[model samples]
Target: RFMCDYDEAGSIGKRYRRQDEIGTPYCVTFDFDSAEDGCVTVRDRDSMQQERVPMDQLADYIAARIQF
Candidate 1:
């Protein structure tokens, strides 16, 4: 599953921790950089690693990386 998290402070680490404690698989963060470039930050629940994803290829990237 995928969802957008627009919490206060734009703290990806904090959000990841909260979601991790609750067992969320993934969280997508849309920041100011996205407005500048068509991309977003995707955090891996288990690894806590983030990577930039172009908006145009986001769907494909997720489909290829996440298996449900």
Candidate 2:
């Protein structure tokens, strides 16, 4: 699940779908602000809801939401 430096050859939306079809629970994207601001965009699979969370606290944040 470590894709911080992942910049594949496709639109981000396309990448999201690829993850979705494969049953990825969430997709965390790192951008310019990620390193500087210490935040990431976390997108949920079932609801497609997204949120910004501090990178330092990401693990705890996701863990809280995972049902199992």
Candidate 3:
């Protein structure tokens, strides 16, 4: 659902900012226990609110947030 071009020095925070500037929406990080947790930190680029939501419920969550 997304794509990126990497810069060697790019930090995760900086990368998120770049995606925000480009009008992209969500980001998912795959850590060791991401699947087990069944939730991930989702950031609202416009509001910068990082919310932890269940992975199995991600589609529903994002669908609820979709603007008009």
Please name the candidate that would achieve the greatest lDDT relative to the true structure: 2
lDDT per residue, candidate 2, 1-68, as tens digits?
33333546698899899888988888888877888988999999899999999988998888898776
- Which portions of model 3 miss their true places by more than 4 Å? 1-9, 32-35
Cα displacement (Å) at residue 55, model 3: 0.6
The clash numbers for all candidates, in the given order, read 0, 0, 1
**What TM-score do all the candidates reach, one by one?**
0.74, 0.82, 0.71
Candidate 1 off by > 4 Å: 1-10
Rank the candidate models, highest lDDT first. Answer: 2, 1, 3
What are the per-model C-alpha RMSD values against the true structure?
Answer: 2.5, 2.9, 3.5
Q: What are the lDDT figures for the candidates, one per model?
A: 0.78, 0.84, 0.71
> What does candidate 1's lDDT look like per residue over 1-68, in tens digits?
46654556536677777878887766777889899998988888888788999988888887898777
Candidate structures ordered by TM-score, highest first: 2, 1, 3
lDDT over C-alpha atoms for residue 35 of model 1: 93
